[model samples]
Target: MYRKILITTDGSAVSQHTACAGVKFAQQMGAEVLALFVAPDYQYPVYVEIIPPSYPSEEEYVAQMRRLGEEYMGKIMRSCAGANLQHACMTAFSDTAALKIVDVAEQEGCDLIFMGSHGRSGWGQLLLGSVTNKVLSHTTKPVLVHRLISEPASG
Candidate 1:
């Protein structure tokens, strides 16, 4: 019964796979999709800079991030276009994906959130942190996570 669905993508194979499901679901439900790509804040670098081989200027970094965002958004846009689904795209700067994702879903009044999940476990999960888990913990809305498999199952 979702009228609006928020889908997050990174242009990765996993996210691309996840996007297909989101688009198909939206098409079936007649729901509007909002595709979001949370990108790194190029204006601010958390890591120490050694200035290795001419580091890009703040403006340059911002522009680069924007270009990447555009390319990533393009994938979802094309999928939506092919499916003839009503959709829009958005990009935001954040090191914390969960915060930005949840914020956008709330702001856009989306009834559901769909994101591609890597399904990390144990040590890797602890070290890298799962964005899906973070969003699940923080958001009040329902989230549908599509776990991307590295390989097809051997029947």
Candidate 2:
């Protein structure tokens, strides 16, 4: 039984669904939930000398990302409230989301991590590295990955 659960979200529809489910799972286990949103760090242009006019400043980027995190975390908050589960939420700025998630889980003493996997495979997965996969590889803590089921294409 998990005493504390770490639920991670990236604001995607699948992640939102998984977060809600994770909240429900925590409620069932009578565990406290720590909802986390990891926003990508602001990246500098490769050609610093030729910065694009529309490019956001670091401050502007952080502010925007924070707002987005709030929106995403808000859903988890509502779910926790509805479930009457003890919970807290935070947003972290980190490009390495997998590392950040593992670090937060350890730092917070979470017994379990609940997160969503997009289920990409083969070349797609290789080209676009999976955060869930990385978390699985790097962390010794228990991770429950909720994979989104895709509907079969209509002929």
Best by TM-score: 2
RMSD of each: 4.0, 3.6
Q: Write the per-residue lDDT of candidate 2 for residues 4-55, one digit (tens) a residue.
A: 9999987666667788889989999999999998888889999999999999
lDDT of each: 0.79, 0.84
TM match of model 1 to true structure: 0.81
Q: Candidate 2: TM-score?
A: 0.85
CA lDDT, candidate 2, residue 120: 30
Task: Evaluate model 2: give its lDDT.
Answer: 0.84
Summarize candidate 1's per-residue lDDT along 53-74 as a digit string, tens digits.
Answer: 4678777887787788778778
Going through the candidates in the order shown, the clash numbers are 0, 0
Give residue 90's error in model 2 in angstroms.
1.5
> Lowest summed lDDT over 10 consecutive residues: which window, candidate 2?
119-128
